[model samples]
Target: MRTPHVERGATPVNVAGTGGHARRSTVTTHERIDVLLSLPGRSPEVTIDDTDVSERKHPHDEEKGAAKLQQEQSFEESSEETTYVEFEEGDPSNPANFSYARKWAITLAVSFFSLIAASSSAAYALGFPSMTRDLNATQFEATLGLSMWALALALVPLWSTSFSEEFGRQPVYIVSGVGSVLMHLMVALAQNIQTVIIGRFLGGAFGSTAAAMVGGTIADIWAPSERGLPMSVFAIMIMAGPGLGCVASGWIEQNPHLHWRWIQWIHVIFYGIFLVTFPLVMRETRPGVLLKRTAKKLRKKTGNMHYRARVEDQIPSLATLMYISCTRAIYLLLTEPVVAAFSVWAGFAWGILFVLVESIGPAFRSVHNFSTGEVGSVFASMIAGCIVGEFIQIYQEKLYAKYYPTKGPEARLFSACLAAVLFPAGMFIYAWCTFPSVPWIGMAMGIFVIMTSLFNIYVAVFTYLADCYGVFASSALAGQSLSRNLMGAIFPLFSEQMFSKLTYHWGNTLFACIATLMIPIPFALYWKGPAIRARSKFASQVIHK
Candidate 1:
């Protein structure tokens, strides 16, 4: 069998004899036909003898032959020509190859989005008293609004990640941003507890897109070697947002005229600004999606149906993509011990953080006789700790840069080692120093240590997972996020009870003991991570470079 070769977007000029006559067919590139009936070019005319047709063994034999011929030809061509959509190592168009300034700009924008969204999750906490009084609900019922928001944050990311993977990131950001703004408006306008709970849940559900996608965006633009600083900044934003929100909402709730509703209104004002600016700053960064779009444009311009991105060939159908997106995180969570361990560790730390968010106000009020504003101001310690963590991360980055080449991704765990000890130490201090005799600054110092340690652990886990999972890092992170946020949602519901039952001293001691037990995880991973990764099917497949 001879193969026909034609230039892209050109009409077919040469024709092979189909029935012994020099048959000519003008085949246009734009024509769509069945693989059996059509060749690369436009129409082709074949001259068959009437007697030869009459003498055929079967009338459909020719059609079967044509289909077989087309299949073989397609197989041979595709086998030789198969290519994927990927950046040529130094391609400037690739997000990873973007200028340092542009990359940081994008990073900061994404971090800002993440910060605001995360802030919204805890912003309502400051207004809990006012909200309960206004809605004629108990404190526990009012707290559900916050917990429901977190539940949505955990659950909605499962679908947001799937959508972001299928469509480009920009679309998800835009749609979710708009929806987030509207949900804030809904909450601000709510007349009763039901409306407030629904609004908070939906707001968090929509707002979660930023939280879910920002890490992936960081991964998209930064190479592993240079990712430390940006990742640190990203982690700081995640930790600081809620603290900052508490600080702001504390003042808002304290104002006699502007109480709980203004918290939602305030968010609307800020989030609305982000919604307007996000489109202008953020572009489509995903390589596969960009390539697919480019391929579509090229095919349209060149009129070459065969012109396609490599990703197009490999991309599963929407159903398959959705299935994978939905289940892949759960599968990784269940099967990958490294992911599961880090997830649980991170989730526990995150849960404690949320518990503090709820308990801190009451703790300050009971221990220090502080007002709402002063209680809100106490969150500054967490914010200060986040800033301190950022500075420490600079040192961590230097250490990573020094060791990463020789140690692989495990070099990123240096801070986690220190954080492990500091976490429990901070908890111990906070637990023991809760007496009215101890100055508030003493407890603030404890929070400072704990928040700093939390930031370090958070960054390490995120960076390590990204390093281990590589291309599938988003899914791995999603699983971690699910666990972390689920804990965040659940821990706060019982925080008041835990503190009440055990008292601040015993309450935090229990948490400190748990933290102490988990300290060995980071140490174990820092030492054994490479060996463990070497043995794992998924980790072994990930290309570090």
Candidate 2:
């Protein structure tokens, strides 16, 4: 018998003749067919409508040729139920099938959403002095705007992650992205500092959605092995936004045409654009959501009422989803040791970054007598560092592929270890070089080192978590964000006092010492990570699944 080639998109149907010869439809999943009919000539065309999911049989002999098809169908259904439930091959709704241009469009839109939210917090730092005078607020009170933004960034992702899981990612992205834009406008129009803080808080609350879901969206499209380059790009955008905001805010504050309020205006305009573009380009990439939609469409077309794609196919009720949004994040944070360790390390780095941002301007102005714009230029050093870190990441990606082809998630830690050492090296350089006589270039070099390390470590950690946790990557990243953002929010509250009491030298030195102490963590994880993961209940379940 000649074997037939299966064509694309055609569901296989088996045609059985009276002589036991059977022809299979090119696209059908059925293995064989039995026929008792004596119908002569060429095989008749039989169309199976959507209603008949089970194999059809003649009334006289219903028992023949039925068992095999039923068994195959049951096995297929069981597989679909157990799997994460991705779209069928060539499904247009799947982000992986999106046109190249569309994928980039979605990526850029999401990046901008991240940019506006992250920039708002750091941009406000530049205008704190003006805000203090205009709003009749103390420096501390004006600082609350930044702190509030950070606090919201920390808190909101916990809830937003759950919503994204239930309602689908596109809805969360649009609603939150637009909500942030509206709050930015309110901040721009605020009558007092109190109003501005409230607006910023609300804005940050929504803005945090981009931070949490963007990676998950990317993951939905790109397989784990192919994700590193895009992950690097997104990581750069995430870190660069804050520093870029500082630079932009410096120029905005110095210009006679704009003031503190314009900072909020800029955020509003930026995010407003993302809000508009997101719905058009950003596709839902969540595996569960995509499968649910596919199943729905299939059910409608086929009229098969018994079709359920998976046990979790039911759309999560609003109340259940909300509860998940509120509770699971805290559960992950408290229970996951991997989360706890990374969160502490990331939080420390973030605290140091914000502290540097808050104090570096004063240090430069007092020591080098640079104008605000000139001081803002100092952030350029960090941009340079970010670029260098990207190169290092590229090289490390190659190294991992070649040397440790199957080294598991810990292989990603090589770059992270380098980052840990680089972090303190930068801190030490900057800590001791804050004197008036030192050239401004020295300070810039120190900052360059600090930022390069930060970016490298960030990408390494991000990739490692995504690789190790697999499906739980979102929650794990959210756990880290909560701790890191909290530190970013709170560290600046006492930064001024630390600078005053200990002097810039000792103050930054303390940070350097702490960073240096963490240098061993990645190395230890590199050696013992598999065992650590084995002991984790969540990690075990995720790995097995």
Candidate 3:
């Protein structure tokens, strides 16, 4: 059979199953990080306002009800009538009802852990000078350590998310947290580059828990309305982590006694603190897993063998969700024009970040004759850029709220439209600003500008796709996440080579020109998005719904 090629806004097919699903009139989880900083596994089914979730009216509700009906019909019944269990009204056990202080505490802790994970990825690059020397590795090989970590980060979520959903986020957090610490330890003690590379891969695999799972935990604990702030903080942590890591490790690499190994050791110390306190602080937040545990206790105490959690009755295997999420995301990437366009745009933006990671040290160290510590200090501008973006987001919101009723999702495109021009503009600024005669502050300003542009791009892509796809939003976002991470992983391997041969001026210029080419994308989508989406079969499903 010939494989069919999917087209942009052109495939007029209604692939149904999640048909009749209405988007949560209230769940705004996508108003923040997810597609930019995506949830890898089975995201927690969210909402606490309604005790009888099945009774709630929305897009996903119909899908859930349809799935639940099928499960109830096939459910094996014991001679003792098996009754389904769920959180009751005013049930104190429901995590969503937790006091604001407690909720914030959980949010802060997990977000911090996730911050460390993101920091680890970029900080590994800052250590290249020392690590490559001591391990007798090539630039490409040393880069592999970072790339390996990213590969595992992108792939591990395929299964790790299943574990988090199955056992609970806390247990998975603890186990992965400890393993993450050990991987850092392994890298610190490595005798060769091979050991270092392996350590980085495992560190990222274990550390993968921090990124996706934090998003899951947020959804688990916060009601739909309450999630906006926490989710924003979580996104900040992920984006800022790499810059923070570079700052610290750059300084550490300069210390004669410390060098690269200390970079790993420092994180080991941080992860150790996270491991010890996390289990104490974060309760099992998955409501389904918690409800299942409650059913077990009730069955044992009340001597009722037939008590079962309603969530347990219809739980799809991890493999099934993984298969659908991975395949469908790929399908969307290939077939859906909106998903394809935004994903490519977001993916390149993410790749530029990694390119910066590889090039920053050399760019500053050689040109400005900066010390390792000073070069690292330069990365702090990324944080500053993100801070600027957050404030811009406030204005974007004002525009969004004021115009959203009339503009629809196109309201999001306003910032993206500006970001599209700013993105390549920022790259051009950085590309040209690299002269020794020019003050180093110019480079720093360029990084800050680039990051701000990226921040807007991330927010716009994630939110727009979420709005367009409805019940299938995760698949769309997952496509974005996959491409972003893959490019993120692949960019560094070639970046150093490009920078070395083309020179920083032209290498970044090439990136800027490519970014220039993409500038029209958001503009095109903005003017014609409604029309384009109207023609899309998958998007049309959500549009009609």
Q: lDDT for every model?
A: 0.79, 0.73, 0.79
lDDT tens per residue, model 2, 1-545: 11222234334222222111111223222211213211133333343243343445565344444555566666654333211223345656556766767767777777777767667767777876567778888877777777888899898777667776666888888888778878988888887988988987997788787677787777777766666766776777888877888888888887767878888888878777777767887777665665556545544755643232331333455566666556655677788777788788888888888887788878887878887778777877877888899999999898777756567777788888899899999999998888987778887898999999988878876777766787677667777888888998899889988889999888889989999999888888888888888888767665522
Count clashing residue pairs per candidate: 5, 5, 2
lDDT of 3: 0.79
Candidate 3 wrong stretches, greater than 4 Å: 1-82, 302-305, 543-545
State every prediction's TM-score relative to the real structure.
Answer: 0.83, 0.81, 0.83
Among all windows of 10 consecutive residues in model 1, the one with the lowest summed lDDT is 15-24
Model 1 ranges off by over 4 Å:
1-101, 543-545
lDDT of candidate 1 vs native? 0.79
Residue-wise lDDT of candidate 1 within 257-280, one digit each (tens)?
Answer: 999999999889888888777777
How far residue 210's Cα lies from its native spot in candidate 1, in Å, is 1.5
Model 2 error, position 258 (Å): 0.9
When summed lDDT is taken over every stretch of 10 residues in candidate 3, the lowest stretch is: 18-27
lDDT of 3 by residue, 409-511 (tens): 7887888998899899999989998889889998898899999999888878877887789888767877777788888899999998788899998999999
lDDT, candidate 2, residue 87? 39
lDDT of 1 at 382: 92
- In angstroms, what RMSD does candidate 1 have relative to the true structure? 8.7
